[model samples]
Target: MGETFTGASDPKTARIMAFGDLFKAASHRMLGFAGLAIALGGLGGLIVMLNAKPEERLLPDPDLTPGAVVDVSLEEMCEPGYAARVRSVDSSERKQAFRMYGLSNVDRRDYELDHLIPLSLGGSNDIKNIWPESRITKPWNAEVKDTLEDVLHREVCAGRERLGNAQWAIRTHWIQAYRMYVGSEPERFVAHSRPGF
Candidate 1:
């Protein structure tokens, strides 16, 4: 992971470049990456990064998106409207995310710049905590994840679930986490899809 790349001389881009953008912006910039250790995402009963294709990868690389968060009391995190009050991801950051995923020309409707761990769970708006979750993909798209997020938020606020576990679920395998917490059809959805379950 010590091996790194440099990116657009712009100070901001330097901080935002990711694997796809590194390749897509080859003519213009690069960025450094560390913590190559990956968290698992599953498909078809096996853990892999978005079907295991690097260029086609859909989920955030744990090395790039480790789900940043800030320390907050459960009460603070669980307050109604808390996520809305704290949520903030600018347009430029959204562009950065699409570029980071090598999605320069994709239809905006096809994706949502999303938080890995939701703001409701104390997730930060840091570039490192966000990714372009698909709006089109089925069985494991952003909408489905939203259901899981709401469930987790309720669980955490209810004192029935630990905040850390909710955070961990988003980072590791949400599909699996969904089974345990969301009480949905396991067969209809699953993917360690960036630690779903």
Candidate 2:
């Protein structure tokens, strides 16, 4: 015979060709999936960076008084009537806060005399607990801080978080705490209850 011709010539050759095609298809699919994963990961990182709030680097007044014994517990602050009383902001105190932060020339509407550690988390009314947080700031404004305050208070009241730790977290690095709770920097300051409130 001159030459015998079969589609695959032999069973072994046919099997090898089939496996090669299958391997090529599988590798192509895997490469596509890997590219997609890499693109998605980069996008996620970009979104996080865009939404991340910048740290304010604010420090509470060192000479000011700290939380006193009478106002030391979250339980005491969480009481409806007590919370209301502590939340009160007299005009003089607000002005004093502005002065404390050297913000006398700044517009009052542009900022809030925020408590360094919110009263809802058992922060005292002392000057050390107060600061002038700008509302004009992108993500870490007084309103954003207020949202964190509410969440932390709820956690403390429910025994899911320690009151002392909540206070310390805000005092130490509120922007970081905000990122952890909000999952991104705030784009605007809108007061809405977070999940698990």
Candidate 3:
């Protein structure tokens, strides 16, 4: 259930090859009904893609993680070390997050189990608020999002932005939020956490 003889590298490629194999096997068994099997093979490709739900494309997969937030007031959220005090994602929850994203046999470092709304903005650590953010996904990876989180937290803490609005913006379409709030130059914000924790 891995790579085929043709050496289809990625999982998607491997699955497509597997579909071809299935079509061939069916053709062998059904004799004259090879065309029908080929048709089904095409359909199977769509099914494989549907099964492979990505954690995010441009925005988040709203179905899997729409973001959840705990009841923390402005003062608490703005307080120093607030995110650190509230931040907690145990191993079991992390594993559950992986399963939710249809990921298995993956290196944890390859993905960041990201909080869609982010703890800094009073986002909940509930499983519903989390998703496996691909570290490899360009221009919108976890690190990129972290910048937005930091920016939003600052805005919220400074009374420049509403907590709910900030949360909603990030939760719904962080890419847009990045533009709306963090501005075009997000690289400057990277690796710079708001001190204390």
Most accurate candidate by TM-score: 3
lDDT of 1 by residue, 1-197 (tens): 11122234443223233333443343121121111213222232233223433223445656567668876778888888899998899999888878876568769898888898898988889888898888776556778778778877876787765676667655555544555566545333332222332
lDDT of 3 by residue, 15-132 (tens): 4345445433433334323335446666574344333322224344556676788877788878999888989999999998888655788788989888988888878888878988
Instruction: Select the stronger candidate by lDDT from 2 and 3.
Output: 3
Q: What are the Cα lDDT values of the candidates?
A: 0.62, 0.56, 0.65
- Candidate 3, lDDT over the whole model: 0.65
Residue-level lDDT of model 2, residues 44-66, one tens digit each, is 64444334324412323323422
Query: What does candidate 1 score on TM?
Result: 0.65
What TM-score should be assigned to candidate 2?
Answer: 0.59
The parts of candidate 3 lying over 4 Å away from their true place are 1-58, 185-197
